[model samples]
Target: MKKVKRTTIYDIAEKLGITASSVSRALNNSNQVNEKTKELIIKTADELNYKRNTLASNLRKGQSKTIGVVIPRINQNFFSNVIAGIEEVTYQKGYSLIICQSDEDHDKEIQCVNTLINQHVDCIVISVSADGNDYQHLQNVLDHGIQLIQVDRVAEELETLKVINDNVQASYEAVSHLIEGGYKRIALLEGPQNLSIFKQRKEGYLKAFKAYNVPVIEELIVENAWTKELGAEGTRKLLSLPHPPDAIFASTSDFSALGVLDVANAMGIKVPSQLGICGYANESFSEITSPSITTIDQFSVYMGNTVANLFFQEIGNNDTITKPKIISIKPELIIRGSTKRNG
Candidate 1:
């Protein structure tokens, strides 16, 4: 196929018998160009099918007006909702987004961040991957003088703008609710302890037990059970114990909670009567299950909006020594049939 050349400002200027600079200024809507000449240039450019070189133009302004986002999974409801919220705010500001998924791999997360840095993005927003233990790549982003915003999962050592949920309080409330339901022995399905969110959740669980004077059983707590299959496996192990728990809290996610419910059903264990279940992150399926799941609502979309707004607000400030700010949104506990044993 024969190549067709793209029309440029110079071509439009030649057609209008004017300088290329005039055409450039007119195309950019610069007031330096008079109305009459601007109209003529625009008309000629339209006739020539001229398209402005946005990349070149943005480079001159010292910014791409683009933000890069790195997330663990793009298809997950919570992350997708967060992306939608970011788009809602960024779109109105004439900024574009470059979204990349790490798929919960640390290496891929690093690659995504490096790619964003190479793109000269004005800012980078990220929810770190599960396997991430090193943050030198994230530090590289700051070394290049680009704005970095961490949301949800974050690297605690770095001092940057962060938006996160009050995981500890949310988990505390969930466990307290289970205890209040007269469930004496409760099991816990926990995520990777390397992540701060999971560690904080565990803290909440322990705190709840202390507050109620309930003895904490070490055997009932299962680690690395953030996935559905893992949760199910954990549940089976817990149920097989000589003294089984009456309640289970899947503090990792609703998917994990669903796994617990599935295993209980297969084992002929009735929920809220013989067993109780609670989950984190109020996934869509949580409410539609046989017995609706008691879960925490993270307001993921609102968190995304807050992340973008924080970026914009910080970018506008001229102070170079701005201290890192952290904004924590409180998650709400939604009571449902899964844990409503008394009612």
Candidate 2:
């Protein structure tokens, strides 16, 4: 491969017929260089397409000025919004982000973490995959002296900086709303049990039932039904049962609820009137659906900004070891045609 040489300050100095020291002082915005000379040097540097070596500069200061972000899926609405939010704050602070997708695979998640460690990033922000249970990779990051922060789907055991939604409370609210709206048999579409977020959601579902004195039906609970395909399969089986549920709470994501909607449409079952549905993650498509799916707003972008700001606040003060912090955001239940039964 051919390497195109990068334009450096020296190239600008040569082009502008000036000493390299003068060019360096001007680039650094130092008062040592006169205003007129600084202006001339900057213009010449811009003309030469000169780029400052941020990586080298940061290395000299013993910091990377870069953060490594590991997410389950970049294409997902929630994760994407969070990344955008993190970028919004990090960009203003002159920090660069290195993003990696785990694809919800444990081995791949490990690889992503290892790669980030090798890169020597100042900090790493992660949302563990559904299949991730062991977090030696995360421990290794901390051992390597890299600041580690967990967001959303995180490992509860690891004592680190964490930003997440109160899943149990959110799930409780969603189910409570359904029960209040007259849903007799509310089914649950669950994700991987190993993940703390999913477990908390399931706990919330059970808690709601207990609070209302509703009988728990073991058959109505579907495991590993976090995705649309699995959600659809689970719904197909549920609706086929003689004692089908009157409502379904897709506690994983909005996509799963969308799958429930699809299955209901194909089976000619009426929504809200016949089978009410609720989903987590307030995706854009949720509002556009025919009846509009009732879902939870996790404040994904805000969550991301919070995560980024936390990193800056703690890391800036050199206080990573002093405390283990957990920031929780309350999720909101959005009522839509899918869950609104009142005529």
Kindly report which residue pairs in candidate 1 clash with one another: none
Candidate 2 lDDT over residue span 148-175, tens digit each: 9999988888999999999999999999
Question: For candidate 1, lDDT tens digit of each residue in 127-205?
Answer: 9999959999999999999999999999999999999999999999999999988999999999999899999999999
For each candidate in turn, the TM-score is 0.95, 0.90
Predicted structure with the largest TM-score when compared to the true one = 1
Worst 10 residues of 1 by lDDT: 47-56
Clashes of each: 0, 0
User: Residue 51 of model 1: what lDDT?
Assistant: 80
